[model samples]
Structure formats: C-alpha cells, structure tokens
Target: MQVMDPLTSPKIGGNHLFCYALLFILIASHVSLSASARELKVEPKGSVKDLVQSSKATKIKRTVNGLLEVVLVDAKGLKDTERFSGGMDPYVMIKYKTQERNSPVAKGAGSKPVWNKRFSFRVQYPDYAGGNGYKLILKLMDKDSFTADDFIGETVIYVEDLLVLGAEKGKYQMLPTKYRVVGSNKKYNGEIRVGLSFTPIR
Candidate 1:
C-alpha cells in the first residue's frame, strides 16, 4: 500500500480527539455539579435542634436589686367589721417580703377610708434564693379596744413585672390603681387604691 502525505491525509485522529475531549468535559462538568450540590446542602435537622438548645442555654437570666416605694391611696366599700360603732377605726397593715408597716388609723373613716401615706422598703429581685418575692400584701383592719383586731379584708399586689421593667429602664412608676380586696370568706369585700415605684441601683 502506498503511504499518503501527512498534511494531505484526512484528519481521522481529530474525531477521536474531539470525542475524548467531549468525554473529559462531561466528566469535569459532572464533578463540578456534584461539588456544588454538596456545598448547597442544608444542615441536618438534628443539628438545627442542637443549635436552638445551645442558644437557650447561653441566655442570661435577669436579676435586680432596688428600692421600692409604695403609696397607700385609699379604700372604698370596705366590709364594716365593727359590731356596733359610729364608724370603724380603719387602718392598714402593709407587708412586703419580711418588712412590715402600719398606717395611722383613719379614725371613723368607715366604709370609705383614705390614708394617702407613703412607705419605702429595701428590696431585691429574686428576694429569696428560690426567687418568688415581689409581692405586697395589704391587710385592712378595724381597731378594737376590747376584742381582737378585726380583719376587714386583704389585697395582694404582684410587682415582679414592674420591678423587671424598672431594672431595664432604671426606674418605673405605676399610677394609683384599684385592686380587689378579699376577705377570709374569700369574697370581694372592697377595692383598695395604691401606686408603686421602683428604682434600680447601679
């Protein structure tokens, strides 16, 4: 067989080279796509759960130490606890944490009594080690000369939210609001009006 000139011959090897290059390109494209898919994959749901739990574990619990000022405004429709009297000698016994205060008697003020007195207490958020202390108890009483002091009614004021707000803002105030007074019989005997303020220490 006669040999053909190298340049004049048909480029038979070109098709094979092109086929090889096409195969190589397809393989490289597949590899690049697979890598991109892996990079775009979302983390497992379990990992997301663990991240949320970690966030909660790192969250800080708020604590505060401050001064609390209370204003004893007045009471209305109190259960006249006196047996036979012109008007019951009404007074208030205020209790907060372990501290106690007594208001001067609203002598003969009867069903509606007004004290408008101010009292202060040294206070702490999480007042006890177990942490549930922001409560104020007001016990209405009738002074008696011969018998035991009468328990007219009582009202409880929860100051946890107010204290927390004060701690956040450095101070907070609550205008006089009425709270229902409950008697030993567990009935709403009257309503007591009071105001509160808290100031946090640096």
Candidate 2:
C-alpha cells in the first residue's frame, strides 16, 4: 500500500487550490452584487412624505360625497324606568358625525322595543371622516309628555372598523351583530341591533 503525501502531489494540490479559488471568487462576486443591489434601493425620508401625500390625494378623490345609512333594527333589555307607571315609551336617537336623527316615539313598547327605522346622513369627507374614523352613537330614550326624554342606554360604534375591512362607497356594510348599551358610568343595560351602510351621494 502506497500513501501519497499531499505536499509531494503538486498537481493534486494545484487542482484543489484552483477549485477553492474559484469558489471564493464566486462567493465574493455574489456578495458584491448583493451589496450593490441593496445600495441601488435608496428609500429616502422624502419618499415617505411623497407616499403620504399620494395617500392623501387618493383619499381626497374618495371624498366626493357619501351617505351613511343607520338602521335602528331593535333593542332589548332596556332600563324600565320607575319614572313612569306603565310600560315606558321608548325611542332611539342616532348620532353620526355632526348629524342626528330621532326615531318616532314608540308610544309604549317599554323595554325590548322595536323601531326598525332607517336614518341617513350626508358625509363630505374631511368633515365627517377626515381623521381616523366616524363614530355611530345610539341612545335609547323614554318619551314623556311633560318632561324631556329620559336616557335609557347608549352605545357607540366606529365606522372605521368596517371601512378598513375594504368597504367601498355605494355599498352596504352591515355592522357586527349587536352592541351592548353602556350608560354614564359605562353601565351595561341592553343590547340593540342596527345596520350600517355607505352609499355614494346622488
């Protein structure tokens, strides 16, 4: 058996060194190219500002005109006020943006009243929704002949959530299922069913 010493095998050593040198060149070239590619992608802070301005411009195009339709489906578990003897007369008040709509006084339905009424409000962007979101407010009240209507329960819903879910104008986007009513100190009293949708202005 003959063992060939690596030091004595110049041809073999040369081949091995050549292979390693080729591998090193390939690796170095790859790294250099990658670094140059990265350097070509220079994203400046002004690019960020440009992107923000582009976003604002697109939003302005969407700000043509829209109508937010809030439908007061029904409400349950309302506070039965001792301020009255019989079943309390209940109605729902809806406030969205700077617009408000009061449902017809459901004469004497008391707790668990049903309105199934729909209200619409005009929205010109940057006015109703210039910032983050527009909030939908629903308040249950008791109508009285002599005194002002009594507040039963209230809940607030944000249109931003639905809008972010890819709600386009002229399309109806129903709100979640129902909202629990919370009072002055965030007291839970009842749950109300409502639907929300946006439509392009005519």
Candidate 3:
C-alpha cells in the first residue's frame, strides 16, 4: 500500500476549491444584504422629508369666526352701459360667502355713483360652503326696467388677514380704500371705494 501525499492529493484539491466557492458565496450574500439594508434605511428618510415638505406647502393658516361689515363708499369712472337710456342706474350687489345684499339703486347716476351703503355678513373662516369665504364680491349693474340688468364692472376685497388680526386684537378696521373695478370686457372701467371691519366673536 502506498501512502498518498495529502497536500497534492486530488481529494484535498477538490476540498480547497469547494471552500473557496463557499467563502465567495458567503461574502457576496453579506454585501447584498448590507446594500438592501442601506436602501431600506435611506428610502424612509427621503419619504419622510417629502411628506413634511408637502404638509407645509398645503398648510392652512389659522382663521377666526366673526361679524364682517363692509362699507361701499362710492364708485367713479364707471362705464355707462345704458347708452340708449341716456343715463345708467348703477347699483352694487355685494356678496360675502353665502350672504348677499344689494345697494339701493343710484338711478340716473350714469358714470359716477354714490352708495354710502353698509352691509353686514356672518363670516366663518375656512368657509365650509366652498370658494373663498374671506373674499367680498361687488358686482355693479345697471338696473333696467325693460330688459335684463347690465353688468357694468366688478371689484373684490380680500379680508382674511383682517379677520385674523381682528381675532388677535378683538377688532380690526380698514379705512376706505379704492380698488380698481374690472368690466365684463376685462378693462379697468372704474374704481370703487370701500371700507372693511372685522369683530371676532368670543
């Protein structure tokens, strides 16, 4: 019987190859798992950051509930819609949220009209009725007896900041200011002077 040299034996060489293959497989599997763990950790952090940014972008500012008073002082440079009638009967239809009021007609006032009217509205911030509740819409119209009312021009007032400040200070007032009025033709047809006040309810 001849004794085989273990170092040069075929079986020993085969065993070495098998050990190297096993070690290579183990290292590759470990590297793959580490990369997967890193991805799992990094993805959530990015997602969380995106979620935070989105939340901030869509955040709604704080608002208050209160009574809002609007004063329609006057309007000037209005378009005379009743060219055939010689003079225009201009009046303003004021809207706040779901509330609506109409100013007394300035019959035959023509291009310039004076209302000096005060209107009141119950306001709740972030109105549930849809649309901007803090906005006041003033639609100027020429009232005609024989036909439909003519749309002269319109103006808008934003009172959200006023309401918020009023909530903080119990009341807020905006002195009469002139806002440009736009007509149905999308031109600056006139200007309207208006004042606003907000009183927050406790």
Candidate 4:
C-alpha cells in the first residue's frame, strides 16, 4: 500500500477553483436558458383560417364557446419601471355589444370569468337580442378586493347568429378579428389562445 502525506498533498490552486467556477456558471446558464424555453406554454389549436367574418353582418359566422388560456411573457425583455401595486388574483373580463337592425342593443355586458391559477378563462357566449349578431371586446383585470386594472392585451370577437350565416354562397364562413396591447412594464408581454367546442343548433 502507498501512503501519502496530508501536508505534502498537492493543494488546490485558485486558478483551478476559478476554472471550476467558470464551468459551473456555463452549465448553470445553459440549464437556465433551457428551463425558460420550456416554461412558457403557448399553443394554437385548429387553424385561425377557420375563422371568417361575415360581410352582411358585423359578426363572425361561427359560434365560439370554450376555454381560453394565456401566458404573460416579456415581449421586449424590458424591466418594470413602476412596481405593480395590484393584487395577484388576475381575472378575465368579457364585454360585449350586440347590433341588430343597425342598432346597438347591448353596449357593454361584462362578465367576470372563472379563472385558473395560470390566468385562464372559460367563456360562454351569451344569448343576445333573440340570438342575433354581437360584437365582443375582451379585457383582463388584475383584481384586489374591490379594484381592478385593465390588462395590456385586448381583443375583439364578433359573434354571429347561429341559425343563419351571411356568406354569399349561402354556406358557413369564419371571421377576422384583431388584438392589441400596450403597457408600462417593459417585461410585461402576453399571448393567448382559446380551446373551443362548437355545437350547432337543431
């Protein structure tokens, strides 16, 4: 058996320690980047092409009903200049406007949707003006006990009558809508997609 002296053993050098630290940082950075890439869950179910807007009516031809989930991300990787003094229980608010006979019956019928911990909402289309056409504006709210902040991202949904469509070919068609967002937080970025199930009226 070979014996080695404890005091004479080669002491670890600072350079060696530094090299170890560098390696550790590199590995840690790689791991962190990989984790972030997988952290955000964003998915698009079905094709947006399936959504078409009607020319005759100001509403989309298809009936939409189901779950909607969104993720908040850093669009520009900007930092928050102002601290958000808002509560953590964020919610989704759906505001609708129904138009029939070139008249607006419902201006803003708002609903506070049931939200999951991840800030997701399951929204239902309401019956408006005898099942006629309706236009919707959806917004998010950061809620406390009695206060709310309007979310950065806002979208519009045009809900049409179920029984009859306004397509030229007398066939069903989809609609087009847009969403826009602006915020003070440089890091605050968001994207959303909805999972829906459609039922035709008999």
Residues 123-197 of candidate 1: C-alpha lDDT, one tens digit per residue:
876456433366898999999888898999999998876766666658888899999999999999999999999
In model 4, which runs have C-alpha deviations exceeding 4 angstroms? 1-87, 98-133, 146-151, 159-189
Task: Tell how far residue 192 is off in model 2, in angstroms.
Answer: 0.5
- Which pairs in model 3 have colliding backbones? none
Worst 10 residues of 2 by lDDT: 161-170
Residues 89-163 of candidate 2: C-alpha lDDT, one tens digit per residue: 888888876677999887888888888888888765445443436787888888878877778888888765344
lDDT score of residue 86 within candidate 4: 23
Off by over 4 Å in 3: 1-63, 126-128
> Whole-model lDDT, candidate 4?
0.38
Model 1, position 86: C-alpha lDDT score: 65
The sequence of per-residue lDDT tens digits that candidate 3 reaches over residues 92-186 is: 99988778999999988898899898988988755567576568899999999988999999898877677655665688888999999999889
